[model samples]
Target: MKVLLKWLQDFVDIEDNPAQIAEKLTMVGLETEEVIYTKELFKNVVVGKILKIENHPSSDKLKICEVSVGTDTVKIVCGAPNVEENRYVVVALPGAELQGNKIEKVNIRGVESCGMLCSEKDLGLAVHSEGIILLENSYTLGKPIYEEVYKDLDDVLFVINITPNRGDCLSHLGIARELSAVFGKSLKKIISKGPKLIGQTKEFKVIIEDPNLCRRYTGKLVKNVVIKPSPDYIKVRLSLCGMRPINNIVDITNYVMLGYGQPLHAFDYDLITNNTIIVRKAKKNERMVTLDGKERVLDEKDLVIADTDRIIALAGVMGGANSEVNANTKNILIESAFFDPVSVRKTAKKLGLSSEASYRFERGVDIENTPIACEIAGNMMQNFADGQAVCGVLDTYPLPYEERIIKFRPSKCEGYLGTKLPAEEMEKRLENLKFGITKKRFEWDI
Candidate 1:
């Protein structure tokens, strides 16, 4: 799992550098495999505004742009059709390096070009881009791109070696929880005060066949969604965290999954047959095409999420292509569920398919995070995709999660660790970890 330092700071207030935090995490058993400094990729890149544009003396397509970088002004030769005076843009100065190509003062069409203007593709922020990246007037003129314009890029990435047993640490929220416990800080909560729902949602229904295989399923209907590229902040964070930003709906789901440690799926509501979602065992020889465009043969032991006519998703592994969100999709059904790890692991291994969602499912995700994740996704969908939430959530929680209580004796724990610690100290530590404690005569129920 790759944990961004800035993202971690959102949950816990820490003043330590990357190396210091890495050492602390390593000491606490969340082994930090590698620490990467991301600002190196964005070094020397600053925001600049075009002062003026003049026709090049030697070329028809080339134009000379006088750009102001706060303290200095430099002339750059650009050939983009969108270049105009007073437009804020990304500037890669002469000493900067972008995508391994170093920028240097060069002569273009007999004019000395001091630096290069950058596009989204040039900065590794997007797969394709047509013109230079434009900045809003809110950005400071001479600020480094990593410092303000794209702060997510000016970060340290920690490659953590998470054990299979620690499935709780697979996401940013989980890691933040751990750090908060370790540092004795409070974990900041994410609140989603979304758009008001009209009434009880009648658009879709959920049915779970076996409560043993699936613990809980929660869904929200978002309507009138516009499919487009996500905002710069969302896309940049996704890219930095190793997820390709797709359309707005899909990216929102992926972002919430990474943030909450809960896997989520968005299905095209218009494609769901009979407006029903049935979670049950797969029939023998059942075949379906997944989102990756590959047909897979299923067995009776495999768990599946089906509509009235056919399977729409492979339960916790992957979604079917038939219900995928597309450019024309207007409404979406966002799914958040907790599937049994054994069932998900078996199916994913047999099908030779693995995804970011499946990886968390196979190890085990938080059952209590189902509705919270749906709420977060819905809030983001409204904020990013121009989507509206249909009043109520469709939830079928056959087996509700129950908190586990363990009897803990402070004396026994101290003896096991060979440390002399007071019972008050032990309670303080457990409280920091968010463990509920019930005081007893000689022992505690945690």
Candidate 2:
């Protein structure tokens, strides 16, 4: 799991640096594999504007561009088809290194190219791209690319090695919670209410066929959503966390999942046959094509999310291509749910389909976070996609989570740890973790 330092700051105010935080997390069983300082990799890379574009005299495929990087102007040879005059682009100046390749004053086809025009792939921000990254007019010229993406050029990324049992720590909030506990700090609370509903709409229905397979399912509708590129901050954070940005709708779901550790899915509302969602077991030999364009066959033991006519998603694994959100998508239905760990694991293994959602589902997610995550995604859609959320949430929760209380003795706990811990300190730690405590004469109820 890749955790951004700035993202963690949303939940806790820690005064430790990256190395110190890594050590502290390591002491608490969350091992940090690597710490990436983005500033070092983006050294000397700045925003530049294209002043002139001229076809290379010696080569037809290459064009010579006069780019203004703030105060200085330099000539660069580029071959990307999307290059245009007056557009802001990423420029790697002399002495800059990209993926270990150095940019320098070199002649390309007899033309002196003083710097290099960079694509997202060249800067290691994306795995593939056809053209150089085109920045919006909001970016300042000659500013470091890192400064535009992150508040501080020194934004750090922690590549954490999460064990199977620690699935709860897969997100920024989860990590922040651990940091708060380890450092004896309070975890900050965030408000996640969606836009005020215009009153309940009878547009959709949700059903749960079995309580054992699916514990809870929550959904919200956002109408008239504009499908467009996400804001710079959302795109940058997703990229920094190793996810490719698709669109505002999809990115918002992924963003909420990353921030809260609860995976969400969006279905194009027009594609839902009956405006209904049914969480139930699949029939034997039923097949559906997923977003990846591969057909998967399932049996009765497999769980799925279906509409009246057909399956829309392989439950907890992946959404179907039939209900996929696209450039023309206007109405979106967001799904946030919890499935049985064993059921999700079996279906994912049999179909050889594992996703970020499946990964979290198979291990388990906070059952109570389903609705909260849905609200967060809905609010993001409202703010970013020009969407208006419908008032009520369609929720089917047959099996509600029951709180567990474990009784313990302070002396026994101290004996297990082989330390001298007072009961008052023990109660303080448990309170910091948000556990209900009831003190008794001889023992404590937690």
Candidate 3:
């Protein structure tokens, strides 16, 4: 699991250097594999403003343009369809190295181009971009692209080696919680207030047919959404953390999963039949197409989220393509549910459709986080996708987890760690991890 340093700082006061923090975390069993300094990746790349643009004389597909690199205006050859004048773009000067590919001045179709205009893909800022990315006017010309585009690029990526049992550390918030205990810092909580719905009405009905497999399921209907590209900040963080941003709705779900350690799924509401969601075992010979465009045959052992007509998603795994959120999708059904870890793992492994959501589901999400995750996604749907969140959530938690209090002895702490830990110290550690501690005569109820 990769943890971004800046994201960590959002939760704790990380005054120690990344290497020091990594060392501390490693000693505590959260081993850090690598601490990458992102700023050192780019060199000799500057923000350039396009001075003029015209068709290349030698080739119809190519265009010749003059760009100001803050110091000098150089003629360059470009071919991006969105290349426009007065827009600031990343320009690779001669002798620049982009992902080990040497960029040098060369002539393209008789045009003497001094440098190359770059896209987000060229800068390694995104998986793919349609054309050259236009920078905001705040970016000054003749400045290094690294300095302007990545103003807060002083980021450190902490590649943590998470054990299979430590599924909670798979997210940024989980790691931050750990750091809060280690560093005595407060874990920042994400507070998303409920939105005033459109007439406080919804259109979907959810039923949990098999509560044994699905512990908790929270679904919400967000209507009139515009699926578009996510903001640059979201895209940049996702790209740096090894996620390919697809669209606003999907990206928001991915973001929440990364931040909260809770996996979320979004479905096109209009595609669901009878406006209903059912969580149950798949019927025999039932087949559903995933977002990857492949048909996956399901077995009776596999749990699935289905509408009245057909399966909409493999429960805790991949969503069906017919119900996937896309550009044309105007309404969405956001799902945040906790599935049985064993059942989810079996289904994901059997179908060969492992996703980030499946990975967390197979491990297990915090059972209490289902509704919180739903609200977070619903808020994002409103903020980023221009959607109106329905007033209430469709929570189908037929069997909520009943808390069982466990007894703990302070002497066991010293015996297990082979250290002289006082009773107060043991209480502090348990309290930091959010265990509810109730004191009796000489024992603690946890």
Best-fitting candidate, scored by TM-score: 3
Judge candidate 1 against the unseen true structure and give its global Cα lDDT, from 0 to 1. Answer: 0.87
TM-score of 2: 0.91
Q: List model 1 lDDT by residue over 1-446, tens digit each.
A: 98888888877787787788898889888999999898887877999999999999998888999999889999999998889888899999999998789999999868999999999888877777888887766578888988888877877889999999999999988888888877778887666453332213578888889999998888899999999888877887787788877778888898888888999999999999998999999999999999999999999999999999999999989999999998899999999999999999899999899899999998999887778788888888888989997766667777877888898888899899898988877777788778889999889999
Judge candidate 3 at residue 193 and give its lDDT: 64
Once model 1 is optimally superposed onto the true structure by TM-score, how far is the C-alpha of residue 38 displaced, in angstroms? 3.0
Please list all clashing residue pairs in model 1, or write none if there are none: none
lDDT of each: 0.87, 0.87, 0.83
Off by over 4 Å in 3: 94-102, 110-114, 124-128, 192-202
Give all TM-scores, in the order shown: 0.87, 0.91, 0.93
- Give the alpha carbon lDDT tens digit for every residue of 1-446 in model 3: 98898888876777898888999889878999998987666667888899899888778888888898887899999889998888888888887877677888797877788888888777666667788878777588878765768665557888999988889999988898888878767666666464232212347777888788987878788889997888877776777788887778888999898988998998888889988888989989999998899999888999999999899899888889989876689998888888999998998888777888888887778988778878888988899988998777766677878899999988876789898988987787777777899998868899
Q: Tell me, what's the RMSD of every candidate?
A: 3.5, 2.8, 2.6
Instruction: Tell me how far candidate 1 lies from the true structure as C-alpha RMSD in angstroms.
Output: 3.5
